[model samples]
Target chain A: MSGQTLYDKIWQSHLVSGDDEAALIYIDRHIIHEVTSAQAFEGIELAGRSIWRSDSILATPDHQVPTTEREKGKAGFVDKLALLQVTTLDDNCDKNNIVQFKLNDQRQGIVHVVGPEQGASLPGMTIVCGDSHSSTHGAFAALAQGIGTSEVEHVLASQCLQQQKCKNLRVLVNGCLPLGITAKDLILYIIGKLGTAGGTGYAIEYAGEAIENLSMEGRLTVCNMTIEAGARSGLIAYDQVTENYLHGRPYAPKGAMWDSAIQYWRTLVSDADAVFDKELIIDAKDILPQVTWGTKPDQVVAVTSQVPEISSAKDAVQQADWQKALSYMSLNSGTAISSLSLDQVFIGSCTNGRIEDIREVAKVVKGKKVASTIKRAMVVPGSGLVKQQAEAEGLDKIIMAAGLEWRFAGCSMCNAMNPDSLASGERCASTSNRNFEGRQGQGGRTHLVSPAMAAAAAIAGHFVDIRQVELAQLEGIH
Target chain B: MAAFVAHQGWVAPMDRSNVDTDAMMPKQYLKCIFKSGYGDWAFDDWRYLDAGDVDVDVSTRRKNPDFELNKTIYQGASILLSRENFGCGSSREHAVWGIRDMGFKVVIATSFADIFYNNCFNNGILALTLKPEQIERLFELSGDKAMSLTVNLQEKRVTLANGEFYSFELEENRRFKMLNGLDNVATTLLKKQAIQDFEKQHKQTHPYYFTPLR
Candidate 1:
């Protein structure tokens, strides 16, 4: 028998029965958000079926809730449809007796952030969410996959998903991480090497010394973008970092149970002789802080590099993609990336909206003023708790002092389903995932960056090498 | 769910790779809470000249003349022949909903993102891939003109109007679901005993999963 990878071990433990053709897998957690969920709830209601394992479900609204005026709950919405969707989730969760962090609840936040914070997603378990970023919890060595709304309903009705096995693809990012480089840059670099579909039909395990050295929050940020590589899911083995993060989280096991859980989690690492279907080793030294200059996440360039020229593309087909991106983003080919002026700066999303990300932003712009060329910049925390912690540490004050709007929690401008959206043709430096066309709002160009990069962009009004800025600030203080 | 035994329709070539769900049904239209109304918003950003939201009626939006879907030749096309990573970002079934609502029963791509591919069969749409050369050939055949293709799920072949055909492989489980219109929910319900058995054993083995919140 071959030694199983972390994913295989979790899969075996969750296998209800059957083969890879149609294996019945027991679902340990289901995280639900509003936009993808309303139809699922409707399916459950129309079918006249109740939740099979309601205890396994965690419900929250992220996509459509207004990040501002959230204290008023459904009444906070200036958009009636948005209000209806947010309240509908509340009614469904209440009616089903499922635990939900309601809009006004302090515990509420992005489903991905809340999952790990509350420890609802634990090691050696199978986690599914309707939103794609659910891979964030895989930082805990869980087999986490993002599901569509239909699968959401199926999980609600059965607590079991009929799944086929995914092949394993291990990505080893070794070597020391350069200063001022973040997990966002690391993952973006990996995605650049592996095109949007490079990890298709496989589950990716992120390993190597660099991955093993990341903080739980940093690891979560990396895993959250797994789907962008078209991977089924992403996983990282449980280690002391995982234990420290989950130790006393609300839903984590307690007392003797904690010891028991740790024993099992200690087994989550891949055995020495274990083999993967495919493997790619990335040296972290080759990575630089990334800024996506195009419509796709894979069309990324280093902050100091020029916007990629169409001729630089590998083939005519690639040039075609580059042409579309260049046209849509209204950028001239071969222009310096740092020369592009920004219309706005947004620092939030499941990927970069964590508390540590807020701290990074505070460090970058703690006393700096927003550049006169920048029209607007804002910071929306991941969860109400994140917002509260930033306020406690006075990070929010520093960010607000730098002239960025400090907003409440929700997906906010990430998807811009609510009132927080970019105007037509507005360019932005954003800490959110996905640089897809019209992702923030129609015709709103977005350059994906790290929190510090976005904060620096807010002050500089253009992309700059974050390392140089940090070094300058350090020297000035000295 | 409807059985997808065979589908024949005008093939509309999307002509781009990495077309995401967000672009298919932009976030503005995602709050509608129902699946049926997303057709007009399938490629909302590109299909229209004016921006749309759930508040503004799509009927009032000006159609972009340059867009493929708005072009007269591809009207009522039900098969989408496109390129690599056809559905890449987000787990929004609304993308599949928008495509289905737009009347596309089959999407031929070089590859598809996993979640979007799964969402397709669940909603009675067939998302399949062909060899690179085959996709290239299809694009060449259909360039700047509306072409018709017959997607036969039963035989796993896509037949062109010129009688050329490409055979693709699909997992038997997914193929069974699409051909029979058996939604996994109804099918999984039949395995209630197995789920219960698994739960019983799972609780005994992994006691932490069932413990009360502290």
Candidate 2:
């Protein structure tokens, strides 16, 4: 018999029924958020259906939550439509009897962050959310993937999701990362190596030395952008890093159950001779503190590099793509990525709003003020807990004192869904994913970077190599 | 929820790569409670000169004559043609809903994002993938004009107006579902007994999964 890959092993364990053409995969945890779940709830209500297991779901309002003026509560939401979607979520969860962390709840944050933090995203489980970043939970060896609103309704009506088999692809990152290079830089570099569509029709398992060396926060960041590479899901085998992170979370298994959980997680690794349909290997040492130069995530280069010339495109399609992106971003060919000035610098989102990410930001800008040329700079923590923890460590004070607003948490400034967003024609050095045209706002341009890079950009008013930031400022990042 | 047989529509060539769902349905329009009104707002930032808002009237917005869909020749074009990785980015079904609401029953691209491709079938929209050369050829065939194509799911081919058809692959189950317009949830519910049985056994082997975390 052929050896099974990690995705295959986890997939077999979750199989409820059927085969490759279509299979009913049992979903153990369904993470729900406001923007996507509202319609799904409406669908179930219209169909006269109830959730298969309300306990299996965790609900929160993140995408549309106001990230500032928390004293006003929901009234803080300046957009009435945003307020409506958020309140509708509360009503749906209330009617369905599902547990939800409300706006005032400290547990509330992005679904991707809150799920793992609360321990709902456990190893060897199948977790689905309406948002694509559900892949973030795959860091714990869970079969996590995003579902659309239609599938979300199906999961609510029936805890099983019908799926076709996805081919297994392995991304092996070898060697050790440099001192300041992060999981964000590594993943961005990988996406650039493999074009945006490279992972289509495949489930990617990230393996090798560097992936194993990543902290759970870093692993989550890598998995969060799995969709950006066009893969529905990304996974890393369960390890001590995962177990340590899951330990003592409110939702994690306790006592003797922990033993059984670990024993099962141990078997989640790929067999030695497992064959993957495709494989891409990268040396971690080859990666630099990366930054995106174009609208597409794959249009990235090292922070020290210049915007790629159209003549350098590998194919006819890329040549055209390069030109289009250069036009949309208002950047000329051959401009140094570091010389690009920014109107705003945003540090937050599921990808980089964790406590570790916050600490990195603080370390970079501890006593420095945001550059005067920058219009605004802010740090939105991933969740209420992340904010609380940052405050406890006085990291928020360090950030705020650097002339950047240490704001409340949600999916703030990641996309234009919330009150926090880029103004028209503004160029921002952002830690959030997706620099797609107008993703931040209409005519808004975004440069995707790591927390440390975005922090340094906020201070310098331009993209700068984090490695070039003064030595004293880089103290704790390594 | 709608049945698909064959679709014949004018091709609206976007001629761009990596066209994301955020472009299909921008974040501001996602605030709509129902999915239907996204028609006018689909490609809101590109289709209109002004920034879109769910609260404001879409009619008041100035239409950008330069946008492919807004062009006089491609007006009401129901087949969206684009380059690789179309519908990449966030998993918003609003992307599919808005495209469908705008009357696009089919999309032909070099490739598509996983989530958006899946969402298309659930909404009775046909998402087709052709080889890069074939897509480039189609772009040349439909340059700056209204060119209609017939997308036959049954035949598993798309026939250009010149009677040349390009074959595409669709797995049997997905083809069957598209042809009959199957509501996947209804079909899955038929196996409730099987799911219940699985649950019973799952609890025995992995009781930790069933334990409530909160």
Candidate 3:
């Protein structure tokens, strides 16, 4: 018999008895957010069903909460959405007895951030949420992914999810990533190499030397973008680095239980000879600071490269898409992306708004001032804890001194759920994921880049080669 | 409730492709978790300013507004006539809520993002998929001063008041639910007795395991 990969073992163990067409998998943890859960809760209420396991479910209001404090129901410019979101979640969670980390609660932030902070996320657990970014939790060696509202309703009522088994794809990245390149850049490069839907119908297992060397934060960044590549979930084999991060966390096991937990987590790695349905090997050395020049994540090029001409594109569909994207973005075919001007800059979201991401941008923008031409810049942290920590480290001061708006932690312009957004025709260099037309706001153009690259653009008033800024910053530091 | 057929009134043409969830309903208006009243905020930023003042004239807003939907051709459109692959990106239900709230009864396009299309149907929004040529005709008629189209769900046809007609398809289950405003869970519960029987039988084969409290 072949050695089972962690994906196979965990999946097989969670399978509950069900029809041949679908397996009713026992979900160990359920994460809910205000956006998708409201309707599901209503469905549950109308169907006369209560939550099956309130203790196993966790909720947080992130997407719609304002990053700045406005008096409750005061009707500030951004207060309408904020008040409605916070109150709606507050009322719903109270009625259903589902645990919620509200705005006032210290634990409140993004659902993904709160899950790990509150200890609801653990190894060998199946986590489901309405938000696609729920894949971020796979960093803990858990099987986590987003589901639709109907699936959310089913899970809330039964604590079981019906799903089909997925094939395993192993992505191996070898060699050391050069200094200044981050997991964000690596993932963007990988996604660019493999079209957005390349990993459809697969659960990805990230391996190889580069992955093994990543910190837990770096691993989380990689797993968080798995969905962008159309993978159901992305995971790194658990190791001491994983255990170290989980230790002393709110929900982590303590004392003897901790020892036992470590032992079990050791068993989560794939065996040396474990087979996979597909394997992709990436050369880390070749990856440079990356950015999205078009609407989709796959429509990317190196920061130094010009936007490719549609005529040269091999695929007819790709050519058409390139033409459409170029027209919408108001860019010429052979224009150098590095020369493009930016109207705004944002460096925050569940994808790259962690403490490490903040520190990286701070290091680059420490003494730099926002360019006079750049009208607006903001850095919203991912979580309350991240915000507090950044403040303590004076990272917030560095950002503010640079003339960027440093606000409270929330999703912010990542989706424009909050007050922060781009005006129409305004272009932004943002660290958020999707760059589709008006993803930041209607007619707002978003060029997705790494946090460091965003900081560089904010300083230069345009997309400059991050390499140039990094070299200058290093010289200053020395 | 009476059965209503989809009428093809004047189809408002939005030639822009890859319209995303945020454009459909900007996130700023997505605060209400109950999935109610969000329809008004669907394009809140594009429609009005903070003080409820019209930022741009309706024609100018549609013609040269900063929002993709405002670009001249797609203004006050009850039926969003678009190219292929509309509603791509995030699986936000706000997109559906916004479209339904905007008084758009039907979205006629060549294709839609998988999640958004499913969401549109679930939230009682009609998403009609048609061939490219048929959509082009609707776009052509949108420019006519005398052109008014109606989407009659009962007829399952989009018709111009002048008798230009186009056929669309909908699954029977979806059609029944939309006509009755029934949610999937509500539909499933109608078969509660069968579900309960299946649950009881399964319980016998798979006894629940209890973990003792420490």
Candidate 4:
């Protein structure tokens, strides 16, 4: 028999029944949010079907909810469309008997953040959600991926997804990460190297020294953007980091059950001789803080590099794509990225809105002031829980004192599900994934960067290489 | 669900690669939770010169003559032939909804991102993958005028207007689902007993996952 990779082992274990090509993978947990789950619940009701197991489904309202209701003096969503969607989600979850962490719920946060924090996502299980960043759960060794709305209904109605197994891929990163280089940069760099479609038809397992050394939250950030690379899912084997993160959480197994769970989790690693359809190796030291200069996530360059000239494009297609992106972004080819000006700075998203991400930003901007040229800079934590934790640690105070708006949690400006959006022709230094045109708003331009880079950009009023930032001089001065 | 056994329609060639879901249906449209009525909104930014808003009349919007879909040659086309990695970003199935609502039934690409591919099948739209060279040939065929092609699911072939044929392969399950118009919700429900049994055993082994209802 062929040796099994971590993905193969978990997939096989979750198989309820099917052939080699297609299987009904038993979903251990289903996480849903307001934006994607409404139609799904509506679908079930239209079809006269009840939720198969509401007990396993956890609902929350993230997208389209006002992130700072207390600050804005608004009780709930003021936009009619946003109000309708959130209310619909609440009604649907209630009708289905599914537990929901609503906007007012103390546990309310981004779906990806809340799942791991509540211990609902665990090692050796399969998790599915409606948002593309669902792969974030794979950091715990779970076989997690984002499903389409119909598949959402499928999971809701039957708790199973009819899935064709993806081929295995291994991305091996060796060596230690350089100082100030983050998981976000590493992933953006990976996407930059592989292009957006590099991992098509494959489930990638990130391995080696760098992968093993990343914190659980860091690993989540790495896996969160697997979709940005066009991979179905990303995985990492469960190790002590995974165990420690899961331990003592609200839903984590207890006592002897925890011991047994750990025993099972230990088996989640790929066998020594396991093979992969594709393998990519990168030296961690070679990676630098990355930022997407163009529309697609893969249209990226290191912070130190100049925007690529159209003439340097390998083919006519790439040249044309570059030209279009540069025109849309109002960026001149061959210009240094560090010299570009930013109209706003946004440090939030499922990608970098976690507590750790906030801490990184707070650390960098502890005593700095937002630049006069920067119109607005804000921090939207991933969840209410993350906000509370950041407040507890005084990360919020540091960020607020640095002249950045510290708002409540949600996917604010990540995809413009709420009013925290960029105006037409506005350019932003963003910490979210996906630099696609109009992602933040209509005709809005985005430069995807790490949290520290975003913070530095806020202070500089333009993109700045974090490595060169004079933090000491900026501190306590306007 | 509607069956997609065979279809014959005018083909519009979109030469660009990595046509992500965000471009297909921008995040601005995600605010409207209801699924249908997104056809006019598909490729919203690229489709028009002025910004398109929800429920805005398409007639009033200034059409972008440069966009592939807005070109007179490709008007009324019901099939989209594109290059590699079509629909690459965001798991928003609304991308498929917009494509379908725009009246296209089949998307031919050299490759597709996984979620977008699955979303197409679930919505009764056929997402056909062709070899790169074959896709190149199709692009060449649709270069001048709008080309018409016949896609047959059972025969597993795409026949060009000139009678040139290209064979494709689909996994049996996906093929079955498309031919019969069955979605995952329907097929999965058939295995309710198995899922129930698995859930029962899963809960017993790991009861920690379930949240107590307040």
- Write down the lDDT of every candidate, Cα atoms only: 0.89, 0.90, 0.74, 0.87
TM-score of 3: 0.79
Candidate 3: tens digits of C-alpha lDDT, residues A395-467: 8888898899987767889888567888878889999888876678767888989899999999999998777
Worst 10 residues of 1 chain B by lDDT: B205-214
User: Tens digits of per-residue lDDT for model 3 on B84-134?
Assistant: 667756767777877777667778887765556667776667898888778
Q: Tell me model 2's lDDT, rounded to 2 decimals.
A: 0.90
Q: Write model 1 residue lDDT over A1-478, tens digit each, in one string.
A: 6778888888888898889777999999888888888899899989998888788888878887788776676778888887788888888888888889888889899998888999899999899999888888899999998999999999999998989888989999988799999999999999899988999988999999899889999999999999888896899998999999998989999999999889989999988777899998999999998999999999999998999879989888889999999999999988999999999999989999998888888889977899999998999999999999888878877888889999998898898888888888999999888999999888899999999899999999898889988622321222
Q: Tell me which of candidates 2 and 3 scores higher on lDDT.
A: 2
TM-score against truth, every candidate: 0.98, 0.98, 0.79, 0.96
Please tell me how candidate 2 rates in CAPRI terms.
Answer: high
Per-residue lDDT of model 2, residues A182-272, tens digit only: 9999999999987899998899999999999999999999999998898989999998999899999898999999888899888888899
User: Residue A412 in candidate 4 has what lDDT?
Assistant: 87
Query: Which 10-residue span in candidate 3 chain B carries the lowest summed lDDT?
Result: B205-214
lDDT of 4 by residue, A1-478 (tens): 7799999998887788886698898887899987788888888888999887788888888878787764442356667877778888889888778889877777888898889888988888789999888999999998999998989999888878888889999999999999888999999988887778899889989999999999998999999999998897899998999988999998888897888788888888999999899998999999888878899999999999899989988788789788889999998988998888999999988889887788788878987899999889999998888989888887888888889999988888988878899998898999998888889998889999999999999998888788886543223322
Better of 1 and 4 by lDDT: 1
Error of 4 at A69 (Å): 2.4
Query: Who is ahead in lDDT, 1 or 2?
Result: 2
- Candidate 2 vs 4: which has more DockQ: 2
- Ten residues in sequence with the least summed lDDT for candidate 3 chain A: A469-478
Which parts of model 1 have CA positions greater than 4 angstroms off?
A471-478, B212-214
